[model samples]
Target: MRDLPTFDKTEIIRIVRRGYGIRVQKIIPYRHIYRLETNLGTLFFKPFHSKEAKLQLIVKAQEHLKKQGFTRFIPFIPTLNGKPYYCYKKQLFYLTRWIDGHPSNYDNPFELRKAVHLFARFHKAAKGFAPPIEIPDFLGKWPLMFKKRTLELKKCRKNAQKYPRPTPFENLFFKHIDYYIEQAEKAIELLDKTDYVLLSKAGKRELPFCHHDPAHHNILITSTNKAFLIDFDYLIRDLHLHDLASLIIRNGKASTWNLKRCEFLIKAYQEIKPITPEEFAVIHAFMTYPYDIWLLARARYIEKKPWPLTYYIKELIRKTKNEKARQYFLDKFLYSYLLL
Candidate 1:
């Protein structure tokens, strides 16, 4: 690992000891993580920086899950005053018992299946969790957001057309703009056909919490075949379909949009928590949105990051190549679930 920021050992030790009332014997650093060996047990200390209110809601959500007999999530070690986090020198920190596992390897089918299964369980356990703190709900705005992104892509296409001398990135974007626009339009059209508003309202009644970022990196698998979900930074009260879509999108992109792998993941998740037809429709709509392409457009046009334009153009080409396979997979899977 490259050089990481040096942390004050004495200060960390004091904080850990004060938080858990344990004696820290040693502190070992590993790639932005500090392992603390203490008389009580091995603990991992990581920097936590977020709005205090948001942090409180996360802690409450985890605690709620634990009470529901879901121990896969890493629980926050309370400070001396029973606070879930500690603030020192304008930095926030939290500790949790060290998990003896490695990041889930998506290449290993067994590991991938276990991760998907555990993710479904996590979503089930996360249901009915009412946060003590109030957080804004944006679940109802999904359609609006999808339409907005579609409009933005149209605007980008127009701007690309008007450029006096289009750069390579603009040229590549224009090349695929038609296909991308078609996808955005399809997403909006399908979204309009579905009762997404009603679904969102009904979903609010149950109030399922989603680990908005359920990528493979967040899943940990042990040698004994046990899986645990680690980070909850993006936890929010949204439909569980959001989490399912995220897993499929992340894994599908990595696997070049493999249809069988996508189906396997969906089946694995369904074995634990079955998805209704309405939910499946929303998932299809979510998958149809060209989120990756939109991000590339934003970075190249709006943000104007200094990264090489060719890199993103190449990515777009790769997506274009995989587009057929992705569509085939979506159609087959959606047909199996929704039609049959």
Candidate 2:
């Protein structure tokens, strides 16, 4: 790395000693994460980017998982004072013991199945969590969420137009933004047309929670074939089919969007915990949504997350360049699985 900022590393070292009572042997920065070597073991440190209330929910959810006999989740290592997080000058940080494993790659079929199995286990364990009064249930809000995100695409387009001399990313975005917007609208239309979603509204505890962002790096498969879930940042009381859709889409791309590969992954998950046809409809809607391109747009334009411009250009191309393969794949999956 380029020399880190003035206050970040120093403050982290100071907080680690004062709060966790551990002498940091070395600190390696991976984007926003800190991998530290300590006397106890290797651990990872990360700052809370969202509300402290969400952090509270995550801690409770993980505790709930443990009580339900779920052992694969990495726990948030507490401070010396037994607090889940350490506060220093208004910044909050937490730690977790690093697992000795490699990130699961979707390209590897065996590891993909293991990740799917562990994911199903996670969903099973996350069931029956009567969330605290403060934590919100998202079961009925998914339709509204789909609508909102679709509307956000219009706003993203307007923001892109405001650029006087549009960057390459913006130009590339303009080229395919309409197609993705159509995809988003298609998702909303599917959800609205599906009679199953009528039950999705005003339902209480009808759905299991999800690991919401179960990216490859978040799942680490060990030599023993055990998969550990690392990040607990976006846990929510949503349909676990959203998680299944995420798993399918990520791996679908690796399989060149092959329908058989997608079917196999879904089969692996069902062998552990079954998915209903209603859930399949919702998953179909989720797959219809252009999540990858939308993520890049929301980060670079909407949230203005300050990611490097080159990263934006490269990722946008990678996500949109193979549009034909992606669309054909979705059509095959829709006809085969969701046609009922």
Candidate 3:
């Protein structure tokens, strides 16, 4: 919370009123979650690090969704000046209609199946909407991120040496990161060869109509068993596997999903849109992307990467607690993405 600013209910209400031209009786800000609530409804808001590029991308995503007739997405609100984005205290802000539905956690097979199906639909629908706006290159900092993370892992190891009976997870992570670095070149090659990639001639892969970050929490399930998606902040063109890989990795650690559940999702997704064989070949590498994020988080923690490092730590701990989660995810994701 210290890394970001806050807006009181009254403050948020004024912003909403001006942006949407609607009055609200109450406003509650969910700081950790990128959303603001008011009596009129829940209006999702994301504070851009005052980056105009990020703000414009969000506006573009909203407009793209609207044009495509995708109803399951959160709609954006215009600012007081009739602009899709606005600046407040040097931070860019955008509002969207708060979607009313319960967020699914994949506690059961049905929910897990539904989650995958919905994700597939999102991918299929997104491909149809050609965004005229150009997205700013945000993920291009990965090489630097990797270098910084290597240093942080060293610090973590150093910290562990001074402490008696250090955390079990830290030692395990030490092995994971070291092993990942050893195999980094292989992983990169696999990524390059994967059929799921939409690469351009310059060697940079085509960013899939990316959801940027698609965790279970960003998925919403309405009472009618319909799913809606939110949080377009991470929307950029990138690897498609990045989306499914992160979802499977995150959920597999927290809960165990049966093979049947996994199959259903993949089947449902294929029904809506198709997956390529090349993408199937690299399911293993995709599952490892979270590890990449962990390395970045470790690096950013020590170097102070100018973004919240706590989320990284949280995800790391999450995977650590479910030590075998990655293997299970690969098993299911590969089985689904490749076999069934």
What would the TM-scores of all predictions be?
0.91, 0.82, 0.71
Query: What is the lDDT, from 0 to 100, of the residue 105 in candidate 1?
Result: 86
Question: 251-272 in candidate 3: lDDT tens per residue?
Answer: 5554564455445555666776
- Give the range of the ten consecutive residues with the poorest summed lDDT in model 2: 1-10
lDDT of 1 at 184: 89
Error of 3 at 167 (Å): 8.8
Candidate 3 deviant stretches above 4 angstroms:
13-21, 32-49, 88-91, 128-186, 192-207, 256-260, 288-297, 300-325, 328-340
Clashes of 3: 8
Model 1: lowest-lDDT 10 consecutive positions: 1-10
* Candidate 2 off by > 4 Å: 1-14, 21-32, 35-37, 47-50, 154-178, 195-203, 295-315
Ranking of candidates on lDDT, top first = 2, 1, 3
Best by TM-score: 1
- 1-340 in candidate 2: lDDT tens per residue? 2343334667778889999999888888877888889888899888776678888888888898899899888888889999998887777789988777999987788988888999999888887777663665577676787788877887899899999999988888999999999999898888777654565542354545778887888889988888898788777777677688888888777777888889889899999999877777777877888878777888877999877899889999889877899999888877877785
Of the candidates numbered 1 and 3, which has the greater lDDT value?
Answer: 1
